[model samples]
Target: MEHLAELDKKHFIHPTSSIQQQQANGPKVIMEKGEGIYLTDINGSEYMDAMSSLWNVNIGHGQDELAEAAAEQMKQLAFSSAFSTFSHEPAIRLAEKIASIAPDGLNAVFFTSGGSESNDSAIKLTRHYWRIQDQPERRKIIGLKRAYHGVAAASTSATGIKEFQEMAGEMMTGFVHTETPYEKTADEAIHDLRQTIETEGPDTVAAVMAEPIQGAGGVLIPPDDYLRQVRALCDEYGILFIADEVITGFGRTGKMFGVENFSITPDLMTFAKGVTSGYLPLGGVIVSDHVHEMLKEKSKGTLFHGFTYSGHPTAAAVGLKNIEIIERDGLVENAREMGGQMLRAFEKVQSELDIVGDVRAKGLLGAVELVQDPATNKRFSPDQQAAPKVIDQLHERGMICRPVSFEGTDIICFAPPLIINREQVHTMVEKLHDAVFAVQKELQVKG
Candidate 1:
């Protein structure tokens, strides 16, 4: 373990992590094994996987079926690119399965390696569809503020998080951000969207992209009617709706996709993460029939956008098995039921702890907002590191959670595996309660 830690420090560069911290502390924890809602590190300390790793892992961890499926496919045919006219059965079946389960009209699939690539492809596909329709100028995309898209060029540009865009240095351009409906009225947010589009000129605006629930942006759920209004607005402007379901896809949101909760079918839905539960990296965009027909009939030779590992046979096979397990075991319903218990648990935490300013959940995806003054919802100063401190307390107590301390906010996010049971939900939230309580005492925040 020490040797591996040394090697990781010397050679490996972690994504979106502090290099200084990595150099100071060799490694936080080397995870060795995982089971339902539990992860055991190399030191043999077992902890609840409260954040589902990176908000994926809907099926939990160490599933034999997914491994067997991958092994079987690899032996038969490990890889064969989906480029040009060539394709394989695994890719075809997975795409078909996604279509059948997806919201209506999004029947066609274009593959990518993961969320970033999927979103990048979706942005390009939107433009490509418009270009083919002789609306080449309809290339602008409007994203919601605090929306977390992905890190690739176009995806980064589309992402509403200022930090991500700043990190990418110069944004790819043709993208604008509007205020999110989170923590506010939908009418005002919708008006902002409308105003932004009109200001950018309706014809130049190609699509409006967003996550059904802003996952990485602190699990901030919008008003119930927000997405519906956005859909109508998009339709009014003849603009495409791109749903980035990278984190909220599959059973994580108590539905196959996050948009289902809002009863909205986006024009193009980009998905990854839970499709294979992180067993392997696989993601894709599901396009509407109109978009599909446009590309099929009008597009010139070579649509010409895809990753080499796009539609990977092994990954696709695992995805099929993953969805099968989700269906057969009724994991989506499990997420819904367990998620209710978790939210109630969080509400209980908020009621009892003054530090817990707010709590919100959409299925397993949830967050507990920590604040300095609960009555005013006044946030703690940055130096306090309230969210990370609570997360550290959770870590010491044998549980893992994510901190959403971005942009002067202190939040602890949770997305336990869909397979998590009622007892596990109760226990995890109980631990979170204890952790927050401990942090409250440490920070000396008074009621």
Candidate 2:
């Protein structure tokens, strides 16, 4: 195990990881297996998967059914290109299944390998749709500040997170970002959207893309009517509304899609993550009937856009069975119920702990904001790296969660599997309480 860890440190290039830390610490936790909501490391230590392994393992882990599905499809037909009239049963059936559960009028599916490709595809398709309408000047894509689309060119350009852009060097042009709705009420945000449209000249804007609840940006949940109002604003300006549901789709928000929670229909919706419960890589964009109709009428030649693994048969097969598991096992309802319990647990922790500033949860997605002074909402010094310290304590206490140190605040985020039960929720809360308390004690001792 030590030799393998050394090999990982020497050869593996991880994403969104600190290269310096990886070289210094080698591999922190070399996981060997996962079952339900817990993971076992190579050394036989267990830890609760509070973050659902990058917020994608909605069905938990170690599901033999998904493996069986993949194996069955591989035996029949392993790979096939989705381009040029070539199609397969798994891709066709998965698309049909996704469309059936998607929002009204969103019945067309364009498959991608994962979230990044799905988002990038949406951007290209949106601009192409406008060009087909003979409105080539409508090329701008508007996104929300603090939003996280993906890492690809178009997706990263649409992202409002500055770090991604800085690391990736220059970003693409014609992508504008507006203030998040959390800065004000839904009505205020609507007003701001109107101002942006008027300032940018609405005719030049092709679409306005946003996440119903910003996942990586600290799980920022907007006002209940924010999406509905955004949909209206897009319509008023003749702009397409795109919902990036990569993290909140496939029952993460206790619904098939996050837009469903807001009772709004977007022209395009990008989805991934929980689509296959992270059993395999699979994602796609759901096109509204209105948009599809326009493409059919205005476009003459081929779409001229697709991926080599757009609809990998094995991934689609796993997705099919994964969805069946989610539906049959009632995981969505479980997420809602468990999320409520988690919220109440966090409320209790906040009332008892002085460092706990705020607690928020929607379905199974949640965040615990830590502050130096709860009364004043004072943040810890950046040098303190308080969130990471608390996360280390969580690891010591046999739990795994993410520390979000962005937007001038430190927060611990949680997104446990949808299949988590009441007992697991209680255990997670208890461990979290202990971890936070430990961090508080260490801080006090240092002071």
Residue 445: error of model 2 in Å? Answer: 3.7
Compared with the true structure, what per-residue lDDT tens digits does model 1 show for residues 343-401?
Answer: 99999999999788989898899999999899998999999889999899999999999
Per-prediction TM-score to the true structure, in the order listed? 0.98, 0.98
lDDT of each: 0.91, 0.91
Where is the poorest 10-residue window by lDDT in model 2?
181-190
TM-score of 2: 0.98
User: Which residue pairs show collisions in model 1?
Assistant: none
- Model 1: how far residue 319 lies from native, Å: 0.4
Steric clash pairs (candidate 2): none
lDDT by residue for model 2 over 17-88, one digit each (tens)? 999999999888899999999999999999999999989999999999999999999999989898897999
For every candidate structure, what is the RMSD over all alpha carbons to the true structure, in angstroms? Answer: 1.2, 1.1
